[model samples]
Each structure stands twice: as C-alpha cells, then as structure tokens.
Target: MGKISYYTEEGLNRLKAELTDLKTKGRAEIARQIAEARDKGDLSENAEYDAAKDAQGLHELKISKLEEVLANARVLDESTIDASQVSVLSKVKIKNKKNGAEVSYTLVSEEEADLKAGRISVGSPIGKGLLGKRVGDVAEIKVPAGVMEFEVVEIAR
Candidate 1:
C-alpha cells in the first residue's frame, strides 16, 4: 500500500483530470506513434519503432505511478484544518530571522507542490520544520545552503 497523502479539493481534482488525460489521450497518442513507426519498415533496424516502444513503456509507468498516488490521496476539508498551527493545507507566513523577509506558503502534498504558486510539499525540509509549529515559534530548517531560521508569523486555513 502506498503512504496516504492529504490534498485540497482542487489539487485532488487536478490529479484525477491528469490521470484521465494520460489514460485516454496520452495512451492514444503513444499507440499512434508505435503504429506509424511499425509501418515504416523492419522493427529491428527502425530506431523510430524502438523510440516509440520506449515512450510507451515510460507512459505506462507514469500512469501506474499516478494511479497509486490517486489511490492513497485523501482530500482534506479546509474548514476542519487547524488555524493555530502549521500543517498540510495550512497557509503559513514565515519570516527569515537573518534578513527579516517574510513569505507565505501553503503546505501541500508532493504532487500538489508548486513553488511558483506558493505551494510547498510537506516532505520538503522547510515544510517539515514548520509542521506543527504555531505562531511565534521558530523553525530551524536545513537546506543545501545551510541551516536557516524562520519564525512563524501567521497560520491560516
């Protein structure tokens, strides 16, 4: 069994949509490529055929992985989330202790993480450090650069 991961409604829906697209449109496209390559000539000497076959394998692997993720995914109700502490789906504002720069990030599942969108995976170093921390708490996170200190400024659903 895969480890269960919590997601927001929008994130779960997006994952389902992607899985559907991969199984339908994505599989059809790969099948078409394989057929076209097969029609060219001998399979042994045809690099296109080999490439198409490889692509099909990769595509199927992606589908399988996605299915597993969906199976273990549980949607978290925003209303039920605790606003007092940082956790998955919690929008947290943290201030860098050194520079006093503040940034907001929503903790999400690995599949739902998008740095540009201010969503971060709970598995990330910073996210792990911030988990369960309440406002005014300091989180010491170890990144590739070094250990950085951040103070939890706010937590919201």
Candidate 2:
C-alpha cells in the first residue's frame, strides 16, 4: 500500500488539474511529436523518432507516478486540527535560540512544500524536530550546518 499523504483541498485540486492536463494536452503534444518524427524517415535511422518515443515513455511514467500520488492523497480538514502543538498544516512561529531570528512556516506535505511561500514539508529535518512541540518548547533539529535549537513561539491553523 502506498503511504497516505495529506493535502489541503486547494492542493488536491491543483494536482487533479495537472493530471488532467497531462492526460489530455500533454499526451496530445507527445503524439504530435511522434507522428511528426515518423513522417521524416525510416524508423531505424530516425533519431528524432527514438527521442520522441523516449519522451513519451518519460511522460507516461510521470503520469503514472502522479496517479499513484493522487490515489494515496487525502484532504486534511483544518477544522479538526489542534492548534496547541505543531503538526502538518499548522502555521508555527519559531525563534532560533542562538541568533534570535524568528521565522514562520506552515508544515505541509512534501508535494506542497514551498520555501518561498513559508511552507515546509513535514518530513523535513526541522519539521520532524518541531512535530508535536508546543509553545515555549525547544526543538533541537540536526540540519546540514549542525544541531540548531528553535523555540516554538506560537502555533496556529
């Protein structure tokens, strides 16, 4: 069984839209490329045909992987989540113990993690360390730089 990953409704919808595009427009483009390459010359000597076939294989593989992800994906209900501790979908504010730098991050699924948007994957090192931590709790996270301590300052939806 595939491991279940939780997502927000918007995230799930985005994935569905991408999958639809891949099955429709993406497949159509690949088919067009293959047909165009086939018209050029004999199959044995056609590098373009071979390349198109390879691209089609890769595209199909991507679609299959995405389908699997969607099959295992579940939409998380924000209303049921407890705001007292850090967990997936929780927006948490943490302060670096050494530098006193504060940053807010929303813990999300690996697929939905966007550092630029302040969304961190729950599977990440810092996210793992912060899991289940309440306000005022210190999380000792082992990052590439070394162990860094972050104090949980606040937790919200």
Candidate 3:
C-alpha cells in the first residue's frame, strides 16, 4: 500500500493533470516508438526493438507508481490549517540561532516541496524538527552537516 500524502488543492490538481497526460500522450508516444521499432525488421537481432520494449516496461512502471500516488492523495484545506503551531501547510518564519539569519518556509508534502519557492517537505530534517513548535520555541535539527538550532518567529497559513 502507498503512504497517504496530503496536498493543497493546487498541488493535487497539478498531480492529476500530470497523471492524465502520462496516461494519454505518454502512452501513445511509447506505442508509436514500439511500432516503429517493430517495422525495422529481424526481431532476433533488432537492438531497437529490445530498447523499445525496455522503455515500454519503464513507462508502465511510471504509470503504476503515479496511479498509486493519486490513490493515496488527500487534499488539505488551507484555511482549516492551524497556524498556532508549526504543522503541515503552515508557513513558518524562523531565525537561525547561530548566525541570526532569518528565513521562512511553507511545510508541504514531499511532492509539493519546492525549496526555491520556500516550500519544504514535512519529511525533511528541518521540517520534522519544526513540527508542533510554537512561537518563540527553538528547534534543534540534525542535518547531514551538523546539528543546527532555529527559533520560531511566526506561523501563518
């Protein structure tokens, strides 16, 4: 079974659109490739046919994985998200305890994480440490480099 993942309405819609495209255009393109390879002749010695078959298997695997993700997805209502403490969908402002550098991030699911956009996955090391923290609370997060401390400045939705 796939793990359940929560997404904002926009994120969910994006995922659905991708899945639809993969099922339609993606499948059609792969079928065309396979047909072209088959027409190239001698199956026993055809490298193109072998490569196309392998690609078809990979394509099907991708479709199955996407279907599982969609089946386990749940859309979260942003307005209903609690901003009192850090949690999924909460936009949190934090200050680095060591250098006093401040940054803000929106906690989202793995699929919706875009670091450039200030969105972080709830499963990330920093996000995990920030979870359930109230304003003025400090969180010590362990990353690949080392442990770092951050102070919660604010939380919003």
* TM-score for all models, in order of appearance: 0.95, 0.99, 0.97
Report the error of model 3 at residue 125, Å: 0.3
lDDT (Cα, tens digit) per residue for candidate 3, span 1-157: 9899999999999999999998899889989988999999999999998998898899899989989999999999777767799999999999999999999999999999999999999999999999999999999999998999999999988
Relative to the true structure, candidate 3 has a C-alpha RMSD (angstroms) of 0.8
What C-alpha lDDT, on a 0 to 100 scale, does residue 145 get in candidate 1?
97
lDDT of 2 by residue, 1-157 (tens): 7899999999999999999999999999999999999999899999999999999999999999999999999999998988899989999999999999999999999999999999999999998999999999999999999999999999999
lDDT order of candidates, best first?
A: 2, 1, 3
The top-ranked prediction according to TM-score is 2
Worst 10 residues of 1 by lDDT: 75-84
Better of 1 and 2 by TM-score: 2
**Candidate 2 — what's its lDDT?**
0.97
Clashing pairs in 1: none
Question: What's the ranking of the predictions by TM-score, best on top?
Answer: 2, 3, 1
TM-score of 3: 0.97
Taken over the whole model, the C-alpha lDDT of each candidate is 0.95, 0.97, 0.94
Question: What residue runs in model 1 are displaced by over 4 Å at the alpha carbon?
Answer: none
